[model samples]
Target: MLLTAIAPMTAEAAGEPFDDEAFLFEPKWDGGRLLLHKQGERCEIYTRSGRIVTEKLPELREALADLPVRSVLLDGEGIVLRGGRPVFDDWAYRLRISQAAKIRTARQTHPVVFAAFDVLCTDRPHLEEPLTQRKARLGELLQRGGGILTPTVSVEAQGRRLYELTAAQELEGIVAKRKTSLYIPGRRSSDWIKIKHPRLIDTVILGCRSEPFELVVGLQFRTVKNKPVGRVSKGLTVEDRDRFLQAARELRVRQEGGVQWIEPRLCCRISYRDRSEMHQLEDTEFLAFLWDKQPEECVWPYT
Candidate 1:
């Protein structure tokens, strides 16, 4: 069946397979995946899971109004530029807008750029073709693009090199793909892989909660070893938070200030970009929480 929803694959390989093999790779964007449908006089935006986001972005709808194709389904991400840098948080604001004033505020203050990467459907059906061919056709279809369409490239080695550089430069990571692999929807096959950033650090779990939320473990850590650190709340998703809450009854610890002290045995590795004031604030708004330091798991890139 033709794939719709996309699943990101983890990168376990440190280097490419030694063979001069078949693969095409591109920079794994930090933004979310957006599937667009421009059919005749109608336009709709869908997530990989088929969640419609048509009304969320008026600016995007207006920008693509000039496209030639009456009907087109394209895959891409909405990115925002802040301080001359493309910030994922700026794009995320568009997703979080719930009021007209908020939407207008986003449009006027935080503009978005639709970076189209693939053409799922054109006036002519092209979804059945191999990814290599479809990607080429996508390039041809979006030819009249300015900087709005950030086309993906199919350079495996170059992608790997870029991945290495991104690690050094503290950028996110890259996604690599087998040139011949079919586009499998919501499947994380060997065809696609991600090499994420590698930077590890140990942190202390100061406290955890049970009622306020689930497995929400509050953390406090010193940037430098042996230095006094402030409270840095993080380390749990909504789902995990619930689970942790249930589990907290069996794993209680002493409370200190806003922190709950737990066994400092579960230090996680994390990754993050160099502290940019804009991206930091942007990330906080995107995550709905302030992030003082990168996650511990980010340091140990190899899971």
Candidate 2:
């Protein structure tokens, strides 16, 4: 039961992928990290932040409870698949359902699966064991789960190949984990590195939202024309936020419906996974302010 509350281990970001015989590469699923604790017939699922989410995934809970092991603690992702690929938006939607009836209905219509990547405990703890051993144990323990529960597939010494496969499939990315590394709960360690397929774009700051502090960014066209792409706030540090707000004070043009319009003089770099059908940026994260670049230089085509 204590393992259920344990913070999951985190991975650092790697700029690029490399071939390493000592590393095991696995798909970086775009879903929420979850810990599953099952003892006897009792099963509970917890998010990475330690919030209990068992009520939101009844089908997954039941499937995990039926595992052949006596008691097991699993580290994995909670994903909702569409066309055999994990969709974070759908998985996120499932997490937001609170009403009991709605959750039950969603479980039937929009089911989520637990893709177990690591095994922390089986009858006893195995945190100090090396990752290669833990992975072998994980595969053995998850041999008989239904479709609702599955093991994450991985390749040894083929990080580049796996990364290429993920890119071709348009998956999130690949995780390169050292085979000899031990799981360190709650720590972001270099032993496990995540290589994501993110695209970078430079955009002009069009405005700012007062509440929750988000920057409205757009791609510059002609000197006077702009096309709004999306809003970004994810990667801003406190200092960066303060600096932007201070700069905005002098550039304020007008306030329209809770948004403070600026003079579109500042430019910032953004990292995102892709663009939506409507051309809005998806999974947008603010990288940094482009001081050397002009707003007019952040133009359309993003090249």
Which candidate has the highest TM-score of all?
A: 2
Candidate 1's displacement at residue 81, Å, is 2.8
Off by over 4 Å in 2: 1-4, 200-204, 208-251, 254-260, 263-270, 273-303
- lDDT by residue (tens digit), candidate 1, 126-205: 65577788788788767765556557655654665776665565445666766666654455576666655543333333
TM-score of each: 0.63, 0.74
Deviation of model 1 at 242, angstroms: 27
Number of the top lDDT candidate? 2
What lDDT does each candidate get?
0.54, 0.86
Q: Alpha carbon lDDT of residue 263, candidate 2?
A: 92
Q: Give the TM-score of candidate 2.
A: 0.74
